[model samples]
Target: MLSRTLLCVAFASASTPLLADTVWLKNGDKLTGTIKVFDGGKLLLNTKYAGDIPLDWKEIKTLESDQHLLVKQDATTGEISKSLQPAEDGKVTLANGDAPKTVELASIQQIMKPKPVVTDLVWKGNIDAALDFQRAENDTDDYNIAFKTSATHGQWRHNAKGEYNRESQDSLTTTNNWDAEYSVDRFFTDKWFWDGRITYKRDTIEDLARQRTVGTGPGYQFWDDELGAFKVGALLNRTDFEYSNGEKDNFYSVSGTWDYNRYLIGKKVEFFTNGEVGKPISGVADYSLETEVGLRYKVTEWASLNLKAEKDIISGSDNGDLDKTRYTAGFGVAW
Candidate 1:
């Protein structure tokens, strides 16, 4: 019923001419013109003197204009509808009033179509070292030596981290857990951004755990320039944690992120700080306000190294004894 309603509004409506609208039918043919399709697969495409060609297809290709050097065709039958909902990532969601499929504009050829820049594209990378000391420095306190590296492009970011943490004053030592992760984000305008994450985390404390999270809420770009920009955004990451202890906990975070960096000398100075004051929204969970700061140097225009230090201030009614500080130092090269 929803699909039919949208199809009526999309295809049943009277449309002016669309400039260079193109459609390629499933039978191995491409049509350049304006097209409107109903829920039952009925399609109307209009092109110059050739008139409107009614079509029915099992599937549909893209609707594009201006590419094939077909600009002379002119938009006489329908006005390119700005009606197509534009996404922040600058792409059309291709909602023919039917099941929606996301399409990235960067990969698509620009048409007379409207592609709104829904989300800003961001690219970043860093390597840093941290020095950490446990509060008790006793037999059970986690002591550490660490290393970390990360690089990110567009909506995706990846990180690899490792460390050596000792339990107690025992000569017995344990290797820091090895960790790797991938994360992505989508911006839905109106100061709203959605984050999706996938992780494989291994470390001394938790052994091995794969976590997933979706963070979304109000966000803004405070500053953007060669020096740095302040981004003040609020978000909530609903997370699922599967620990090596054969235990499961679900946590949600109401957090804020602040990131800024600039060049210093021939190197670069990068700083990122994120804090989340949150408690487990479900099940039995650990809560903490986590933060990390770092400075990185660019060896060349393509390489960088950094030192990072982090502190977790645990203060909920359930986590008074679980306090710890951690650090890591590392570097990376990128193209």
Candidate 2:
């Protein structure tokens, strides 16, 4: 038994040399590490001391690898190669075997695992929770929890999200909210898409006991890259609302949604914002708007610290206190 364990350890140690790749920077720096990802003009390398470091591709003079890589040249063209060697005039030689090809570095748009790599449906999500407590002549407690998930396959993307918030003062409920939303997008072109969304929410602070909205429209992706994405959509929607005073109303509206996200500081920090606005064509209110902004610091691959602020405003309200705002800071996990 001892001999078998020792043999396995020795075998693993002998195979370590085959995993390394070499990167040469324009500044005459040479780094040997494992390339994990290269996207949006940045490359991620896993090094012994740095763990994972992101380097701008423009700073790299050359890349040499014996590991198999999937390189996509354009939207519809791709190739698999086991070697990348420098060629003349900003070109690289992709060697699969005896048939070697040269392509310009700027022409390569994306890279991933080698072909025959079966990609399952991409699924990702995050969850966060926060709590605030105050003790004085009157005690107050606040809790907020949120979850979001998304799945993508080919040109179709789907997302679902939910949030719950509650506040109590002197053991009496002061504010409570429950919200959920689902959306789907189908892409026919790189920049143009169709989207549909549904939302349900109940809020006490806004004097809204229940609200439901449904919409579908055309959307445009301004840009979607490794650094971030920006998108805008115009929707025609139907909304129904029930107030706490037992009053009910419904309306048809023209709505718009916009989202923007960016990553900085070597992808360790993120800034995100999204907003929605609607103008009623057959209702009492002139307009309604909701917006949220968030900043997140990635502590690890799956954990982060986040701060968020949100605001909602209704242009004309039966109740004077229909406008609401909130701020929360907490931790989140994603995968």
Per-prediction tally of clashes: 29, 0
Superpose all Cα atoms of candidate 2 onto the true structure and report the RMSD in Å to 1 decimal: 4.6
Misplaced by over 4 Å in model 1 are 1-123, 128-171, 179-181, 188-192, 198-200, 206-212, 241-245, 251-253, 265-268, 281-286, 317-321
RMSDs, each prediction? Answer: 19.1, 4.6
lDDT (Cα, tens digit) per residue for candidate 2, span 1-335? 99999999999999776657778888888898887667557777878877667778778777877777877775445677787876764577899888999887777766655534433244666798888899999999999898887775556879898899999999999888999999999977667889999999988766678999999999998865445668999999999989888898898899899988887876688898888999988746878998889988899988999899989888875554357899999999876
lDDT of 2: 0.80
Model 1 RMSD, rounded to 1 decimal: 19.1
lDDT of 2 at 62: 72
Question: Residues 82-189, candidate 1, lDDT per residue (tens digit)?
Answer: 334334333444444346445543333212222233122223344333334454545434444444443323333343444444454444454345444444434353
lDDT agreement with native, every candidate: 0.47, 0.80
TM-score of 1: 0.44
